[model samples]
Target: MSLIDNINKAFDHRIRLGIMSILMVNDYADFNMLKELLGATDGNLASHTKALEKEDYIKVEKQFIGRKPNTRYSTTPLGKKEFQKHIDALEKLIGK
Candidate 1:
């Protein structure tokens, strides 16, 4: 298969790309942190996150902190592998 064919369509959106990039570096990030970093609205972030979740690219954790609900996101092992593949494909496409 060609390198371009290896690209993950799930990351076609810049928002989803940003989400994976952040998760790659951080062990885990909460909803508020992602929203603030991406400068996206609650609905925007929620939808994007849900998409990633449905693809099994990210794991979501829910809990309560001092009576407040908290949602954290982290990349799964499979996610890391697939994301790295996507990055590699992009690099190859650019002849890097």
Candidate 2:
């Protein structure tokens, strides 16, 4: 298997890709923020985030702001490296 195969596996769905892309730039973003950005349902985002977290691809921090609890996401150092590699793999696939 090649590198693209790895990235392809990482982002099997476009929703997953969108999630990672958003987390790449920002240091941290909450569940609501991600849902707003991706236009995804809570269940949808939660499921995908759980998948990434299981893979050790993203770090999740849960805390409360005022009275309500929030889940914030940020790419782990390992995740950051993997995402960059994924991008490079995509560029290769595009013949760049």
Candidate 3:
């Protein structure tokens, strides 16, 4: 298979890539944290997250932190495997 074929289209966008990168290392990250880390606006982050969630690449959790609402994101098992595959593909491409 081609290296490009192993790259996940779901994580093609910078914002989505950022989200996955963070989730890979973090147990979970809240919306505000991800926004700050990625330097993405609310709408932009939300859209990208929704896209990942739709692909089952990331799981979302909603809860109440006192009176405020909290949305947390974490990578699914499939997400981690796919992301690792994508990284491996990139590494192979670079090595070539």
Top lDDT: which candidate number?
A: 1
lDDT of 1 at 36: 94
The parts of candidate 3 lying over 4 Å away from their true place are none
Q: Taking the tens digit of each residue's C-alpha lDDT, what string does model 2 give over 1-96?
A: 575475658766877888899999999989998999899998988999999998898999999899999889999998888888888888887889
Sort by lDDT, best first: what order? 1, 3, 2
Q: How does each model score on TM-score?
A: 0.96, 0.91, 0.96
For candidate 3, give the lDDT of residue 27: 98
Model 1, C-alpha of 20: deviation from truth (Å): 0.5
Clashes of 3: 0
Prediction 2 TM-score vs. true: 0.91
Model 2: lDDT equals 0.86
By summed lDDT, which 10 consecutive residues of candidate 2 come out lowest?
Answer: 1-10
Model 1 gets an lDDT of 0.95
lDDT by residue (tens digit), candidate 1, 21-55:
99999999999999999999999999999999999
Pick by TM-score: 1 or 2, better one? 1
lDDT of 3 at 21: 94
When superposed on Cα atoms, how far off is each prediction in RMSD? Answer: 0.8, 1.4, 1.1
lDDT of each: 0.95, 0.86, 0.93
Cα displacement (Å) at residue 16, model 3:
0.7
